[model samples]
Target: MSTKIAACAGAATLAAALAAPAFAGPAYTNDTGGSFRWYGQFNPSFQSFDDGQEDFNRLTDNAASNSRIGFWLEQAYGENTLRFNFETAFGFRSSDGVNQLSTGDNVSWDRTNIRHVDFQFDTARYGRFSAGQGSMATDGITGADFSGTGLGASNAVADSAGGYAFRTSAGALSGVDIGDAFSDLDGGRLGRVRYDTPELAGFTLSTSYGTDVLKDANDRESYDIAVRWANEDAAGFALDSGIGASWTEETGKADQRDISGSFAVLHKATGLSLNLAAGERDIAGTYAYAKLGYKADLIAAGSTAFSVDYYDGSDMVTAGDSAESWGVAAVQKIDALNVETYLAYRDYSYADTSAATYQDANVILAGARWKF
Candidate 1:
């Protein structure tokens, strides 16, 4: 097996081995026809990085969501429904397959970030409201995606090499952070209360208020509002679009605000897709991203997609510093194996030549994803 497939399969096998004994019984069910089901995903990838001075390889978790297992519970209430979901997972280093629960090997192996633990009430007519830890209104609305290229090449550059360091022409480690400087501010999920309005003529509105995860001190809080329009496969075309704004305030600290939007369109007949996203932040200046792709049944029993994406961020690092990122990628889906295999190449460069520590970098990523 290729490195990608091996890692993907190994992660799945390990997860299954660990989860099987823990989930031996039937899922909880009630008399009201409510049911619960378990679901999970395992994605492992291999990335090669060239910092313009030296090259290295990294075996890591998925650049996207990592590996996870969760449960969904549903309860019927007349025409409405009450739902609860719980999910938790952790990342493992591919190089050694070592599971590091927490730093300092602390007194308690209190590892793992609780990704989601929420309860939702959905009304057929009114809308949906959710409480507990979950995504806010603008969580994923701003970084729109309609192409398969998100696995390796997207506006969120951290997914691929979240820990990699940049090397300068002098062969010295650059102090500038690579992940934040080159990547866009993908929205974050927080412990929040959210309300989403029912779809009205392909439009929906949502709002949320959240306290920071861990309930940090200094009275930290966030609020978000978003509007989205979606019409899938209507008149041989599909559209998904959203716009959102957010504010974060902390007593005695600089308040941060952001405005972000994205649109994605697809031609059903030709399998052609286009996506664009733009955002401005109080600290990170402004950034824009665009992608073009085409999907076709080029392989028997599979669909293949080719795409190119570009991103430009002005003053992304500091005043008068800008970053440019571009990539080309291809993905092939094998339905028989229930796997998606991808290969992608991306380049990163900064425009501030005055800084001796800033330099160009190149990255290549290959990965496979299995979702169940």
Candidate 2:
């Protein structure tokens, strides 16, 4: 009888502790003063593509903005915040055959893979420190662009069906294909330890050391350092800029180093935005990209943006050859519905070093993104 009475008392105390003021709202807080909540985006898109051969329609996962679900936890201790985030994403694609939802087949969530799992500690005076599988310091800094069509303009195309073969004007298969000379060298998410200094005078510095950028078994370390700056208004224009560099040690291979930077400005008064970025890697050559975009009040509660971009890569292949790509993209942002629809057309041409021939590839892509 005494033992039963003690158990009842403990249960009541636990219930009371959960009802504390810190446990308010949808998120739940435990006795340890930590709160946890779930957050994620379900982004699905449909696309019609001209894969240089037959025109086919596909309902695909947006390559640029992948679908993900995750949860976050945080606890405040003194002047510091302790946080944790775990995120995973689906790898649904039309070419997955059995997993394509539109084929009346049972979709497989088997490939829902882990993307980020990290713990962070942040202090106002000491900045932030993070560890685990997450973004490196140099990630996304070089390819930063204010253009609304990031899903189509930059390396995001690789997430889609842009890798399909190209057909020549004569309806014959061209030797070259889209995404062959994609000049994307930004250090992506990796298992690493990273640190960032507090923003001072609109500038922040960061550095990260990782096992490998691609998580490959190279048994070498990757080091990245980056600096970023942002100003709401630089004189009369809004400015965002950053520069980053990375060195990757390759086992039994030549060590690789990459340098990249980007600058973007937007004139709010005129709705004109310009973006410029460049990246270079030793032995891999160099590439530069520029984009000009405009946002106008042509739609009610929405803005339309038209953008044109060009890429030039010198010695992208052999010593004397080069590759070039140009494209046009347009986006309509409906703020009321929180949706953005886009259309893009791109043309690629490259020097065929093996055959000493020049070939071209072209594609047209369209999609819409709804944020929830």
- Per-candidate TM-scores read 0.86, 0.80
On residues 219-261, what C-alpha lDDT tens digit does candidate 2 reach at each position? 8778999999999877788889999999988679879899988
Candidate 1, after superposition: displacement of residue 133 in Å? 0.9
RMSD of each: 4.8, 13.9
lDDT of 1 by residue, 1-372 (tens): 255345544544443333222222247787987999887766666666667776666555664656667889999989999999998764455321211121122111122356788899999999999998888898887567767667666777556654555667787776665665665654576789999999999999999999766443537789999999999968998999999999999888778898888999989889899999888888657888899988889989589898998888877667777878888887777676566767777788766546575568876676676666
With a 3 Å backbone cut-off (N, CA, C), the pairs that clash in candidate 2 are: none
Q: Give the poorly placed runs of model 2, Cα more than 4 Å off.
A: 1-34, 47-57, 94-112, 155-162, 166-177, 213-220, 356-358
- Output the lDDT of residue 274, model 2: 89
Error of 2 at 359 (Å): 3.7
